[model samples]
Target: MTGDTQSWRRAAPASPVTLDDVARRAGVSLATASRALGEHPHVAAATRARVREAAEALDYVASPEAARLAGGPTGRVAVLVPHPSRWFFGELIEGLEAALRAADLDLVLFRVGGPEERAAFFDRLPARRKVDAVVVLAVAVDDAEHARLASLGVDVVVAGGRVAPYPSVGIDDHGAGRQAMDHLLHLGHRRIGLIAVDDDARASAWRTALADAGIEPEDELATTVAWGGEGGAEGMARLLGLRTPPTAVFAHDDETALGAIRTLRRAGLRVPEDLSVIGVDDHPLAALTDLTTVAQPVREQGRRAGELVAAALRGDLQEPLAEVLPTRLVLRGTTSPPGAPR
Candidate 1:
């Protein structure tokens, strides 16, 4: 007792401050303090400030692994696209990455396509416990696959197509299809051809639009093609060989539309003169080709989807939010009143 109790204590080995200590000091629940530190939106401003002050005072540091184990957001997002090589998916991913980076989140890419790959992906559900949320791009899955996807228990925001129980941000497919067809139909073209991706949701919308206009797309004028420039060229070739060729064409996308234009030129026909053309998606090359199109905010759709996921992570958006963005019809050199001077 005489030899200075201070020296005998040896500072009692300074204890590492834990989240529990911060919560105790802030007079809040452990969960509230955790949310405050994680910058979750559900925590009140005053509570967050108090929690932060307590953390600083206690020199408390949160373990990334521990936080995740405790049901906290992992600050990572997963993007599932049918084909990363495709222009639409590639551009969508770019927008999603930009938005995620701005929020200090990481992105994980999963390219799923074809029956085999999709089946395997849904079976594994690899994203479980790996990411905070998932963003699905334009890949339609059957009911069974949808059920499998939902079993992953991750918040999802879709970019191109709608899946139930999850919020989506995309153009209205029906409206977009009608806009494209109306442009061609109003241009005084009755015999209109359709070059669209086979089994795509847009195809159904296009059919409905054509039916509403009392223009039944006959077998000769309707061709279901694969998704790109090659398909466009091939589809156009088949349509041209028909006994009653169409004076105008409505391609599902701008890439296909551009391909159609090339085919028409190769046949020594002038665009909007020998035939009028219209398409969806104001793609990057649309301006160069002067392609008339229904312009949707493709990039914005991805960015907004990212924001929605981030909000979900912060516990700000509990209820599902479905957003259908607007699309505008852009007129250009590719389309005009049929039979206009070359």
Candidate 2:
């Protein structure tokens, strides 16, 4: 009985071992094999030879999919952006396209704006085994979104939000927070207020305390708003109604900042005199309002993300890390030393 059992185990099935199977046999990784055979000039030649031998003995053929990307074939990279016309997403896509073109990779742009389109995207993906990888730019996705992407069994990198188990690229939103707050502190603003984005109040609080900057917002100092200009105006209106209003304000983004300006001016408050204001995102509209901001290098961050993703695609990148970029404080006419609230 023992002899038969051992013999049967030894005489395994004739089906070809996959890349996963070969990695296990070689005491390396699927990534290692791809690095050994592909364009990873950094891998040791001896290591490459070992992988090749194990691959040969197992009669393992490279996945047609891997060859298209990891190898020398013309491959496609799918880039998913939530919306197309938004400035941040548009700049990110431009950077992604620049990188892909440099590598002669095909770029498939998809705008998964709503429920129906997202469903169609995922449904069409299973058959797109030939596609190399995916890039999610600035789209805060839920678990269901991630699960669908994982089901496709392809390399993935997310930009702008922290999607776990996948490498991500973003500015220290918290640092951008600190920078924004620092500007206010330098302007002698103690009675400051905030127009927050969405319902993520913790993010708002954390950003204030980040990098050891800004006033800890009192209950009367900070207010939550929606994601756009209306939210900004509404939050500012609430701040103005308080017994002691803020001398200055910071909004979540440029759009919100503009709304804050509208509210302040309509209330007979003077900019930089009665109520100084600022925001994040150096969006084009921000300039038209002459708003101060923590200017993020949107396109540069996108380019860096592209480079990081490319390194992952080549199998030469092993260390898992969060890449953080820098942001700057851009001063305009809107911000000044805090004065008496009007």
The candidate that achieves the highest TM-score relative to the unseen native structure:
2
Per residue, candidate 2 scores C-alpha lDDT tens digits across 262-293 of: 98889888998888888998999888878899
Model 2: weakest 10-residue lDDT segment is: 202-211
Model 1, span 1-342: residue lDDT tens = 755787768757687788778878987545456667877654557777888999999888887643643465567777888889877888788888888898888998877877777776777764456666678898766788777655554567788767766778887887888888887778788888889887565677667767778877576678988888888988898888988788999898998888888888899989888988888998989988888999998888888888877665554554666888899999888888878986
- What Cα-based lDDT does every candidate model obtain? 0.78, 0.74
Write out the backbone clash pairs for model 2: none
Off by over 4 Å in 1: 1-72, 125-128, 199-201
Alpha carbon lDDT at 137, candidate 2: 84
Instruction: For candidate 2, give the lDDT.
Output: 0.74
TM-score of each candidate structure, all chains considered together: 0.77, 0.80
